[model samples]
Target: MRRARLTFGAFGAVTSIGGFVVALIAACGDDRGGFIQNERAFETEHEGGAPDAETCFLQCSLDGRSIIDSCTGGVVETCADDLACGAAKCQEPCAAAEADRSSNGCDFYFAMPRHYAPSIVSCFATFVVNASNKPATVSLELQGGELDVSRALFRAVPNSTDLEPLEGPIPPGESAILFVADWDPAKPRSVGERVDHTSCPTEAKPALEADFGNFRSGIGDAFRLKSNVPVGVTWMYPYGGAGTHYPTATLVLPVSAWAKEHVVVNGWEATLQGIPVTQIFAAEDDTEVTIIGTKTVSNGDGFTGAAAGIPAKMMLSKGQFAQIAQTEELTGSSVLSNKPTATVGGHECANVPTSAGACDTLAQQIPAFEQWGSEYVGVGYRPRTKNSDEIVWYRMVGGRDGTELEYDPVKPPAAPITLSAGELVLFSARSNDAFVVRSRDAEHPFYLGMHMSGGAGRPPKVPAYGGTGDPEFVNVVPTGQYMSSYSFYADSTFSEHSLVIVRKKTHGDFKDVWLECAGNLPDWKPIDNAGQYEYGRVDLSRQFGPGDSFGDKRCTTGLQRMRSEGAFSATLWGWGAYASYAYPGGMAFRKLVETPLTPVN
Candidate 1:
């Protein structure tokens, strides 16, 4: 429901400031001060010449004082000697004064003079009056609409003359800032998303969850409206991405029992409102409140409270919104503190250090003997291998002779590490830190190992928690879930060949950690039994595959075809996360080595 009002002027000058209407006198027909009629009849009546006294009104200065001269809309009539009354007297309020239609339930209507002399500027001064005298508090907003401020311009002020107003009131004569733009009524605005405020009183706070799967990724949650009152909330989504838009968004929350509140659906930030820092309990539970603006005002109903009007506009969106599935609200605290409250195995197998001592020691071996349920453990390792070493090494566990040791299913609990399937453990003897080990099966006994660079007082810190590095053949009894493992760092400086021993109560097997300098080789051929090896070798070769490939596919194709004839095929899987060696030639996989192998000096 809108209407347009028109005013006439001399040359066509009009300047409107907020609610105040300040029309210039120069725009009037004859350069006389008067309101212009928005009617076609007024123009027809005054088209020919100046209007008579009955049609127009004029004011002038007589003796340094304002005086009403005449109503002719033309020149003032000179009085004759008989009717000479010099003192000014008005028969009624001057037509110019009465033309103010701001009050008395009347529309202003006045006709301008036909013409005026070339020397007078036209101007009209209008003011806003405190009609009810109700403290004269008027919020001079730009759009005649409420805007959210907390997340944007969070405050309002008017202290001294240099007041910078984001939004506030203008004293009496001053008009609010008026910003107008050409708007077509035919244009349709996009339909806003729906919001539900069902859990009003008890949970006045609306929880915001970001949905990244929609056309425009944004935040949303549902709430229960306690009463038919306006509601608004502010949400801050992590900014900066291809799909991000404005810094905020503002929308209206309808009066409903249960409403889904979706903020910033269009990707605009300015359009967003509500408190920025909301208190969330545990991890995913967000705080809800009814009153957004005022401090103390609630509906007082159980699970349904209503506060005073919120200071901002509430922006909500509909379905098909943004979302990230298969993830939980993991607040910062939950990531750092691993609180071990529950245990599934025979013992309280939680937070047990994966240090070699925890796994290697015979006394602490009971925990490793227990079984495991579905769980995950994080293990950080420290490597000290040299850059010049040709082989990138990993710490190894149970594998005896031709048979790989069976992991315990129940006893000797296991805590496994959560490394991506094929991610390799790059060896770097740079740090002096202990690493943890966990098994997927809880019953597998845990073992610890140590790495050291044989300095004076620094005999590498043997993972004493599990056991010391024992290069000598030591028979180990099958205890809990875990079996025996090489508890010492494989010395790169030793005979260049480490010895591996399989110790059992009744049977035993032993092999050189490497192809010994001069010794009886096992019946297993190095090349043929490579798959049964304790470790595998990685080489530099181009990485290429079926549809998508890298490197010189044409050149590598001949070698790939040659290798295809062998018992092995080229690896399509990408290399490890971190680089073990600089293979600018790309990634290539060779045969796995069962026992320790020697490096060609």
Candidate 2:
């Protein structure tokens, strides 16, 4: 199994800003709102509809000064040929085009000429906004470095686990503020004052510095996150087992860095960004803290001490730290939530697409990742109900061309694909049906799920009239069984898909040998005759354990029968009521095993 890679470092900083004082200062100043009218000179537009570079540059330089000049299709030279600007020059060559189109994702607002600064110290961080119907207000937080948020109102509410919002609404078209103020008159303090220059006049030519690229702020111990296994949530549980009904497990990933955007107020190492490191455990020796289980945190505000002078702290007991040490050793062997890499591997491939279209692809395909023996687990989405017994499969259909979805049964659609570790491969549910790749262990069993329609609106809704949604896909191997790593692939950009080599442990190792067909169940039919030519790939490192359960429809199948009382919403707290935790049931029902299919390119 591949070890999880650290993607974004956890950096944060928190400083105080008075209400009236900040409002007054902001009112008096003409903030140099970072605007990207044209993408970088060298960067191409992913949508393939970007205006000409000359047109964009002309529009951007209506004020009579070229901030960034295009060099080639991939590079941009900042500042004009004439040294006609202020101090601080663009260190890195700017893109000729305004957009980083190669990756097919949104361009960084910092890449724009309006706010290109080589370094950012005690100032506003770059804000990015997509071209949506409604504008977006980008909120800036400095976790790894120094920042102060007393003046800014977080667009999203604060959470205890981390100092950044796990989820929030960034409107289309609208814009927000992320100003950096090192010296506040009201506070009468600075991150150590270096200078107190007056605001630049709106008409004055600005300095020729480049915006501070996304950099780390600081890092430290934050929170401990624990997974919760609900009781009686669904029929997925056995009446009893060798262990207690509630299995308590703790996984910890240390926070080593943070951002020092505008909100940071003090020195580094402040627990400003309370990234959920590991779940608190009862076995810990520290009495000052207790296990609060796990809950998804939102916003960039970590739980700080009520008092201003006291530093924010969530110190785990020595025993707790020991537990962290033990679990940290688990690495690629175990699961660690909160750390995007553990939930999904985004760094496996040496190179991953960073542009808009492909960026979303990276995000969507990561969760589909699973380690072979240690964590291989099947992931079946909500499936379709059919009157015919034809082999059925599931696909990922909607969202932006590459907008990926989450796969966590608990965090459905939250992060359908986490690219913390590697490149992303988006799947069109219809064009890309789920298939089992070969397994590794013979005696160790494997598991699979029949994708159904429902939840994130990805699955087909099963209608009444004796309609059984999706296919009841059972595992090819039984408990204590094993298989080797298998390969599974489909058309990269289509929705109607096929699966081949569905059953052999050693078959279809290469992409060419496997033949495909148009209808579902590609391998069930004669492949040599008339099936299309296609292939699928699977990784075996991501394996699952017995009782390691996943299948939203399984529990919903029976639970939906009891839904006559009223239409209900899935709540985080009420997740257990909807979930089921059971040992891989008897083979007669569906063989449960350790090996599962994790789709990757």
Candidate 3:
């Protein structure tokens, strides 16, 4: 995580109609002729694929002039001579023919969350997408519990599995679905036939299954994916209780973005009949993790518990995950790790009060406090039913005891609420309403967790979309953390796809934002504002272009890119009647800034 700082100096220039330009004549006239010659030579030698015409011109003019002024009477030399002398002056260094390539090691740690209930279900699946250009040889190691792991690789056209071992190398752009716990092969076969492969294929495709299995689920269960090339990881709760319960899934963040310290658990709604649990994992072995929670609790399965009034410290080796189940709503609890650690927070199963729908689990990996923001805009899927209301839980962490926070659209808008570190406040509205939140002081940044309801449901209606109205847990990335561009993969099965965009309201009423789907741009709509923040929603499903799909498939599983001229953060929300999930639109690594590297416990 490195922050780059750039400084620019002003240069006055005079231009003629013929395009001739002059500036700083008094200071630059002495060696102007030599400068022009040196500049031309430098450009001829090093201007291979200039970044831009303006940059090239500026470099040639400023750097050439500086060199001439410094090296008066120096003879002009060719690029070859400059290379030998190593004295070529230019705005940018010459491009290297064989530039050093940074190594993105194959080692990756994935934090797996507990399914509906470890005791009731043991089935869990992990999908790995090899997004890199080169093939990847991957190995899996499970921690915290012993569960049989099965792997199946899927490739495009002829979708054959090369008689090679399941642990064999995965071709570039291909994907492998690993089923852990008790899985019934019959279920996958029932949904789609599996073809035997003579060799690994080149293209990639998505695999659908009816029921993977009903095996034992474990808390703090984790797996390490060591690959020769960089890959993307996604965890799937396929179908809990074999379709009796709604399914949910999330995109896994790379380990490089993991942080050493986090304001642990986010908002928990115990009123929803579901229990809130948080799973934490360490990336390195012998990692010391200190847990401070709201109350004392007992450890279940491979999880460790902490006592109230006194923080509990535990040592976790690499790949180890700890599940902390809290009976009471847990917010503001802190988890400080000596080594980088990852965390997932949400309920095993929950229902939004007053929102119609059966309880479904909602969980999201909690971003570290270092990524906390002072501003956020709340958004959600359309209401499942007209009677059902949408709710956004605003949990603030890292603030003083009396830190005041404000919100919009709540009416004479009750007075600002005072919250201390780890405290939470709630706001409710129609599913279509948008709202904004900001802290009184930007210096004291705070984090926000947005929980959207699965919506009110009617039996047999299935809500049109899958998960019909499954609850969604998305950790809102702050506006300050937004990136200008992003590339990501959408869930292949999700029937509805929408992107929630939030921009600083102060930036003006409108800013150009584009969603490039399979190379086509689509129009997006703006929503009514709350305060200090503007909102926009893009329906990717409805905007898919001709090439956005395959043969008959309208939405294929592939990379989708987005860009914005102004600062803004976006979250991709996808759901069907059966389940729903949301993830930040941009890569987490892009938001990272260089910080202290802490040692393991």
Candidate 4:
């Protein structure tokens, strides 16, 4: 739920700090101290009248404390009680970000998805693109389980002819990093059209898969990556490795994107393979996590003691993770943590629909609860097989009580629905279908996920337009999380690679948005409800494929970037034969609440 924001004070005040100065403008509110609410020098909320600048300065000076001149590196200045606290807290992260500017400048941790297929160790490949040019270094250590970390943790230098590291400092203006090891010489010469493996050496031991057995508790498949520079992370299963499923690669969000609360979302798990699993890894020590199951759930064998209304709890240290798995779908389950955590939802093999053919590996990172939005533009994936009428199922889960949902559809209309906290509504639509979901407001945000089952029977062994892909589940990116620009990869390994983009119709025409590979946007249709948003599904397969390896300036290859003058949301999809995968193209990851989030006491 969104919290109340403290309005500004009444009068404007100017202060000089170090070499820079900033002016903020806000409307008037209740009087605060001697300044108008909009013009307070500090954002802090004070009961009654706030302390005057001179008074706060005296308070801090009397304590023998000096304040940092700026959140960025700045000279020390005489402290004001009001500015002292805010400056002190902001300086910590700001200073750290500067130190880590060579790489992603935030906390770094990852709980990679577990893709389990029999007979093979399972190919779990992770790529980190050093987005910065400085000679930034990165280290990855296995966490969470008692597995053989030495063997499972791999270090790769993709550009090196041999498995040696880059001889000198890497160049500048680059934003990604790739690790390469000759794990296997006989594997496919290429993983997907997404990246060039022709230069990757083929000499190493077998690839390592996540330790699924340790998921019942904590301390298993999680891993932590540390870097001095800001970088982008990507995870792909069986891509370069030897496996047939887990078809897609997703842009991994950094630890700054992690949150304290999340709700699980996944495809149908009652398949011949393993069950669906929802996992969380803590970023701080002694973190407390609670799970409220939307259905009967268990980690492994017996019921986990978490049920529809009951909650199960766990204690974890930094880098530790907990998994809640059950054969039944755990879509509406909720997880609460005292500290920030990476929340993931996946299944060993899941059927897109109860009757779809060929179950495939399903994995997608679920966004933090605070990231869910009151509004969503939902679009269905194109059919891969002959069934042109492929239907995508959607589930909108309410985050709070008394949440009323309104659905504006481009096709068959949906009736309004009311939901209590944690409750969800399900609906089905076809490829051409587009809909908008709006709640009363931000406080009643909801989570929505999409599922694609084979049109009818089993998916064909070869690629088919309407007949493609087995059971697949992907989150519907909310309009609120939409970002203005994104750098993402597409594994055209599937015959079909596409993107669904949603933006406010009031903005400029499609030409304003530019794609690195595909020139000029195509296939745009205006959304009906209030004529507020327009949806587009761009077939970008030509941009991906056999060519386009490493770029001249970028440290990596086969990567694509999109930019727009306006804010928008997008989702990526790919399908080939019975293999298909989908996920949000990117996210804003901005804090939804005005107040810093605090754990429920």
Top TM-score hit: 4
TM for every model, in the order presented, reads 0.14, 0.20, 0.63, 0.69
Judging by lDDT, tell me the better candidate of 2 and 4: 4
Q: In model 2, where do residues sit more than 4 Å from their true spots?
A: 1-314, 317-384, 388-428, 435-601
Error of 1 at 185 (Å): 42
For every model in order, what is the number of clashing pairs?
A: 112, 159, 25, 46
- Candidate 3 residues 150-195, lDDT tens each? 3444322112212232545666445555553333334433222222
What is residue 31's positional error in candidate 2, in angstroms? 61
Native-referenced Cα lDDT, model 3: 0.46
Best by lDDT: 4
Q: Identify the runs in model 4 with alpha carbons over 4 angstroms from their true place.
A: 1-105, 130-136, 144-219, 241-243, 299-304, 385-389, 409-416, 455-467, 505-511, 520-523, 542-557, 593-601
lDDT of 4 by residue, 401-443 (tens): 7777655643234434777666656667766777766666666
Candidate 2 per-residue lDDT, tens place, 309-340, comes to: 22223333322211111101111112222221
Better of 1 and 4 by lDDT: 4
Ranked by TM-score, the better of candidates 1 and 4 is: 4
Q: Model 1, 490-588: lDDT tens per residue? A: 111111112222111101122222111112222322111111112112211222222111232211110110100001111111111111100001111
Off by over 4 Å in 1: 1-384, 387-535, 539-601
lDDT of each: 0.17, 0.17, 0.46, 0.50
